[model samples]
Target: MATIKDVAQRAQVSTASVSRVLSGDARTSAEMRERVLTAARELRFRPNAVARSLRSTGTRTIGLVVSDLLNPFFTELTRAVEDAARAAGYAVIVGNADESPEQQDHYVRILLGRQVDGLIVVPTVETSPLLHEAAASDHNIVLVDRRAVGVDAPIALADGATAIDELVDHLVATGRRRPAILAGPDLAGSSRERLAAFRAAVARCGLDLPESRVIHGDFRAGSGHDALAALLTGDDAPDAVFVANGPMALGALQHLAEAGGRAPRVPEDLALAVFDDMPWFSLLRPTLTAIQQPTAALGERALSMLLARIRGEDVPDERLECRLVLRESTEPRSAR
Candidate 1:
């Protein structure tokens, strides 16, 4: 393998000079630096990142922990984060927690063991203590999507309340009085915020959201399908259903298709609205109406925030607004 000594000998410079040039230490003359770099490149030399990290005390690696990789929303978000991290000359290590607190804790320990320079996490409920401990130990940790209970790290989240309010308002304007909700697990911070906003919107519109109308599901397509099926088959089926995220919305659509005679027609027998718009949604039958959170932008921002924190900069928590996109599935009742 090509080593610094080989490159230095080839470039007629000392090993120390070659090291300075490779590290970009700014002490080597420009002409000598160029010659060393050319010699290294010609020899196909690669720096040992592990050795360099040991010397600099920085791995230039960021660890990302997500609740579920199966969800399309999270998949896209991860892509954005990885792309941005790579562009910034950092490596990313990803872990999926499957929405389990124990799994999340396990991943945290593993990442710390790897000596990752920083962390970005989509926290599960009851994981605050672990996060707190990391923070206390001076680890650079940033919360993404959900904030843990006791940790004060910078957070990047969607404006859940505003998104819910907009969805409810759209449903009301389109003549959906009895709107049901498929909420995510109550322990999740995003789910709680969305549900709270939904309830407040229902009350503000003078509509009684009965306990029977609210169904809880994990933020997955299957859970969404099952929850909507339960709600639709119940004694009082909703005139409209608002799903909290894209996968759930897709699941609800799938269930609607499989229910046969009981299937509620979009914008006719029933209206549908969802949070978190995806690329394929607009092309679906009866096109999905949704509140579009900036998924890629959210991921990019979270990574940027974490990087800033890793660099010892103070970054405040941030929330991005979601835009309501009206589509065929939620046409005005009068138009139908």
Candidate 2:
């Protein structure tokens, strides 16, 4: 309940002097600044963020929206983003889109209404009129993970090309001719990019991937489960499957379990690999091969790029690389 007046009295200075000190005004004397800060610390005083934002150039806060909070990849990205934002003297507010465009739009409005200095989003849809308006109005927006089709903003995303190459090479080398893919929403930039890379890599290895084997999901476990189930029950069952993200991978694993009990023994019956890596992946029954994305780097870079945009700096789109991590799930055919 301590106020600016209380701090001013405790510091033996006028309210104006206290305000100047708290605002980081260069005109304040060192002795006066010290006294004001000391008084604030002693009183446990917290500034009114709204009032401070009104008086300053920024709110010192940023808003981040992720497609799905259930995904460990996004959770780690959120943690890294918060860490980087805090290090840069900013606070972060997060919103989970849950792969719904309407939900994403709602959170975008809420964040904008809260007067966040900037926004970073993993857009759920291909295009959004609201996002375009915000960007056009100089709202300091940055796209992370996936780029909205019509939103003209700087973006930070993963480059899955090399990882896909490595995955295809491994599968082909292991004598797996028929490979399947569980892709996320086809409209999402990240999903599209990953699918494209997968196709290209398969072609590079001179492997054929039928259209029926390319399944799309909503980046959720249930969708993954359904997609994998369809593939498993099909007449032309694939020898290997690559899931797009972690939650979906978990779903695929679950489907594998429920579909035929212990019939599928990973590399023996159906090899599996996923796009995103997690600590627990190594502990799974057969262990999982995955593409390790630089999640921390992606978060840090997104914040940095957002900050730059907020400061009126031109920032180009950034794409970080992902590396393939081989594991028990992708054992060679001979070993299987």
Candidate 3:
């Protein structure tokens, strides 16, 4: 087992210098930091993070709870958070809540019990008393990708309103008068925000979005398929559909393909757009249009904000915007 003493000896520096370098103290000279880091790397010296955390009252670890691990958006965000944490000399523990409030709360308690230095959560619901209590008790916490009310923590949100506006405009320009939504569960902040935004945008465009046009799902592929099926079987089916999140969008696409002659063919019979762009979207048969949120940036900024809070710094909530990515699935019927 390599130790700090071995690293200090190899670097020809004092143990204090090595400690300062490892702690990211800006006072350490660049040359000394380089020497210490090189020696540590060469010796494969792993710091006793747990012991240092016990003494300093910090775990040097972050806990992240996301709504759905299977979702590509959340998956990418998780990777980004890990990358950012690693760069800052910290480790991240992830919990997938599977869109269950109970599961999310369980992870929250577990992470808190583990004494993580900070927490970043993509909240499964707007009401989590445990999270609120943790915040009130001065836990270092931040909400990412979703917002939870009554939690005294900074939040990092994406511009859902703008994305919905773009989606509506595209649908209307593509000559789709009737539009529907395959929305996520109502308890989730992201779902509620997107739903409200869609309603407002459609109304602003002088389109009547009846209650029947909106269908709720569990943010899963199966739920998405079911929602799409309901829409297709309806007497007055929509000419365009907006799916919230990527996994659901994929499900809706699959449903459309499998329906054969029973359902409308995309573009020619129906148009579709989705939130959360994926790498494979372009490669799909008809290619899909989507709103692309800065997933990686969201994760990085959320971690940075949580770290700042853990360091006793005050920071404001952050809001990032999504971009509209046009593709064949949303092209005008005439153009396709």
lDDT of each: 0.84, 0.87, 0.86
Using lDDT, give the best candidate's number.
2
Report the lDDT tens digits of candidate 3 across residue range 1-336.
998778878986545456657878675667878999999999999999876556355668989999889888899999999999999999999999988889998898778766688889998889898787667556789999778899989998888688779889888988999999999998888898999999999999999988788999988899999999998888879999999988899889889778888878788889988988999999987999999999999999998998899788998999999999999998888886
Q: Rank candidates by TM-score, best first.
A: 3, 2, 1
Which regions of candidate 3 deviate over 4 angstroms?
Answer: 1-55
**Which pairs clash in model 2?**
none
lDDT of 2 by residue, 178-275 (tens): 99999988898888889999999998888888988999998888999999989987888899999999889988888878866645678887889999
Runs with alpha carbons beyond 4 Å of true place in candidate 1: 1-56
Q: After superposition, how far is residue 277 of candidate 1 from its true place, in Å?
A: 0.9
Q: Which ten residues in a row have the lowest lDDT in candidate 3?
A: 12-21
CA RMSD (A), model 2: 10.6
| lDDT score for candidate 1 against the true structure | 0.84
For candidate 1, write residues 1-336 as lDDT tens digits.
998668867986555456556777554567877898999999999988777657356778999999999888789889999999999999999999998998998898778766687889999773467677666545688888887887868899988677677778878888888989999888898888888889998888888899999999988889999999899889988998889888888889899888867798888879898888888989998898888888898999999999898778999999998888889888986776
lDDT of residue 131 for candidate 2: 83
